[model samples]
Target: MKEHPEGGTAAALLADPRIRRRLPTAGTALGAGLAVWLLGGWRLGLTVAVLVVIGDVVRRSRKTSSVTAWQKSSAAERRTEKQLKSLQRNGYVVLHARAVPRDDDGVSDGRIDHLVIGPSGVYAIDSEKWDKRLPVRTMSHLKLFHGPFNKKDRLDEARWEAQQASSILAARCGFEVPVQPSVAIYGPSIPWKVMRVRDVDVYAGNRARAYLRRRPKILTEGDVERIFEAAQQALPPKYPD
Candidate 1:
C-alpha cells in the first residue's frame, strides 16, 4: 500500500519490483546459447551465463543514465503526498505517481505527481527531493550548494515539462488551458525564500496541502472532475489497471 491513498498508490505499484515488469530476463540474449546446449551441460551453461552478462552490459551501455531530474522529482512527490494527508483535512485529491507522457526530447519524464486539479487551474506538482542547503539567486539558473557540490539543475527541464503538458492538454481538450507548475521540496530546513522562485511556487512536501489551500481555485469541482477522468484515461500502461 502507498503511504497515502490517491495517486501515490499507483506510483508505489510502478516502483514495486514484484509488480513492475522489467524489459526481459535476458531470455532472448541467451536463447541461442541455451538452444545449442539443451542437454544441460555445465560448459554450455557457463557460456550462456557469459553471453547473458555481456548482453546485460551492452543493454546498460545503450540506456541513458538513470540519474535524471524526473527520477529525483518523484522522490520528492512521494514525500509530499505523505505531508499532504497530514495537513489537508479534505478538498484535495491525490493521484500519486502517474508518469506523464514523454516530451519531444526523450528522457525519463515525470508523471503528473499528486495532481491538485482543484478550483485552481490544473496544477502539475513536480517534486524536488533534495538535501543540504542551496544558495539560489533570483532569476538565475545556477544554484549554489554546500559541501563541494558539483551538480546543478538541468537547463529548462522543468519548464519543458510544464510547457509540453500544457500543449498536449490544450490540444487534447480543444481549449487553451494553462497548467500550473510547482516544485515540492522534501528536505530538512527548507527555506521560505526558495518557495518564491521566479513566481513559481515551491513548498516543502509537508506544506503542499496547506500551501494549496491558500491559493484561489482556478478550476471548479466539475472541471477538476473532468481533468481527473481525463488523466486516468491518459496514464501510461505501466500504471495500475
Candidate 2:
C-alpha cells in the first residue's frame, strides 16, 4: 500500500519512538501473565494476572486515545488528498502537507493541509475532522455552532494559513498572489455541500473538488506553473528522509 506523507498525524504517531516502544510491552505483559497464571498457583497467579491486566488496560487506554486522534486527523487529510488529486487530473498543481516556518524563530510550524494552484486561483486548504454526530450551524457574525459549542476560530486559523501562503508567494513572485482560504470539513454532518464565510470557503470533504472546479478562472497555465514553483521554493519539504 502507498504510504501517506511523513508529516501526516498518523504517520508521525506510528513513527514515534515512545509509542513504538510502549506498544509491545503490553503484549509482552499479557503473554507473560498468561504463562505465570498457568505455571503458578491460583492465589499468586490470579494476583499477577489481575495486576498485569490492569496495567495493560491503562496503557491500552492511553494508546487508544492517541490512535483515535490520529485516525481522525489522518482520515480528514486523506479525504482532502483524494479530492485534491482529482483537481490535479484536471490540470491543477497541487501540493500536500506544506510546512511553513513560524515568524518567531523560523522553526517549523504546522502544515497547510493542501495547496492548489490552477485556473480558478491559488488556494491554501485546511482539512478538519469535526464531530460527525453534531450538526454544524452557522450563526450570526460569521460564527459556527455545533451543539452548544462555538467553533468559529477554526475558520480564522484557515484564513491565517491562507494569508501566510499569500505572503510567501507574494514575496517570492514580487507581486500579490491571491491565495483563497478554504476549509474542507470531514466527518461532519453538513447540511449543505459548501458554505462561504467572509473570505474562507468551507465545504464537505467530498465536495471540495467540485467547489474548486466551479470557481471562475483567474490564472493561466503559465501563472499556475510560476506559482507552483514559488511555493515549492518557499515551503518546507513535505517529507523527511
lDDT of 1 by residue, 1-241 (tens): 4456767788877789844434254455466567756777758876886777687766544342222332333455545665655533445555655666665655436555555556656666666665646542233524433235532332234545566666766666666667666676566455563344443566556677667676676676666666666665664423443
Q: In model 2, where is the ten-residue run with the lowest total lDDT?
A: 64-73
- Which sections of candidate 1 miss by over 4 Å? 1-75, 86-90, 104-108, 133-155, 193-199, 237-241
Q: Judge candidate 1 at residue 93 and give its lDDT.
A: 58
Error of 2 at 82 (Å): 1.2
C-alpha local distance difference test of each model? 0.56, 0.74
Candidate 2: lDDT of 87? 73
Model 2, residue 231: C-alpha shift (Å): 0.3
Give the Cα error of residue 55 in candidate 1, in Å. Answer: 44
Point out where model 2 deviates above 4 Å: 1-73, 101-109
TM-score of each: 0.55, 0.65
lDDT of 2 by residue, 9-74 (tens): 877887899778666765776677677878886667667756876887665443331123333337
Positional deviation of residue 2's Cα in model 1 after best superposition, in angstroms: 44
Assess the local accuracy of residue 91 in candidate 2 as a C-alpha lDDT between 0 and 100: 73
